[model samples]
Target: MGGTSSELRDLTNRLYERAEAYGMEVKTGKSKIMVSSTTNTSADITMNGEKLEELTKY
Candidate 1:
């Protein structure tokens, strides 16, 4: 949804903070970042300080 990595990172930060505020756990095990680009840019995207796994298929 974000146009840049930083923007996407910011969104994750907000999501993590909000979830913590509500006492909800963001399951990192079920989280993933699927990139359609030819370059690896989503390695920086994370949830709750843990990097999200990138999938090539599904």
Candidate 2:
């Protein structure tokens, strides 16, 4: 989890809502989200245990 916990928290909330609507639940403990940065460094962004792709020089 990186790139501010607030951002990740928001995303997680949205995902949870969507899943509930579809009779599915997002088990953070069981589910895995990965974040990565696409750039020369290719840094990985992990937020709230979720991984997302981050573009450099954006």
Candidate 3:
């Protein structure tokens, strides 16, 4: 079995909370987050990492 879109959304919300606690700004795009500062942003919490993991994991 694999995770669904709703699961990915849930994980994203969790990550967003974490990011906000760290003073990072999160902007939602079509299916991704537009980070405020390019240099300080990490690709891990963005759509690719979290979303992909959520979709692939059982």
Using lDDT as the measure, the top candidate is 1
Between which residue pairs do clashes occur in model 1?
none
The residue-level lDDT of candidate 1 at 13 comes to: 86
- In order, candidate lDDTs are 0.76, 0.56, 0.47
- Return the lDDT, model 1, position 57: 32
lDDT of 1 by residue, 1-58 (tens): 5667677789878988999999998899898766656675444788876888876432
Candidate 2 lDDT, tens digit per residue, 1-58?
A: 4474466557666777788899986655565544444434444434345665454452
Q: Per-prediction TM-score, please?
A: 0.74, 0.43, 0.43
Worst 10 residues of 3 by lDDT: 49-58
TM-score of 2: 0.43
Q: Sorted by TM-score, highest first, which candidate order results?
A: 1, 2, 3
Which scores higher on lDDT, 1 or 3?
Answer: 1
Least accurate 10 contiguous residues by lDDT in model 2: 39-48
Clash totals, every prediction = 0, 9, 0
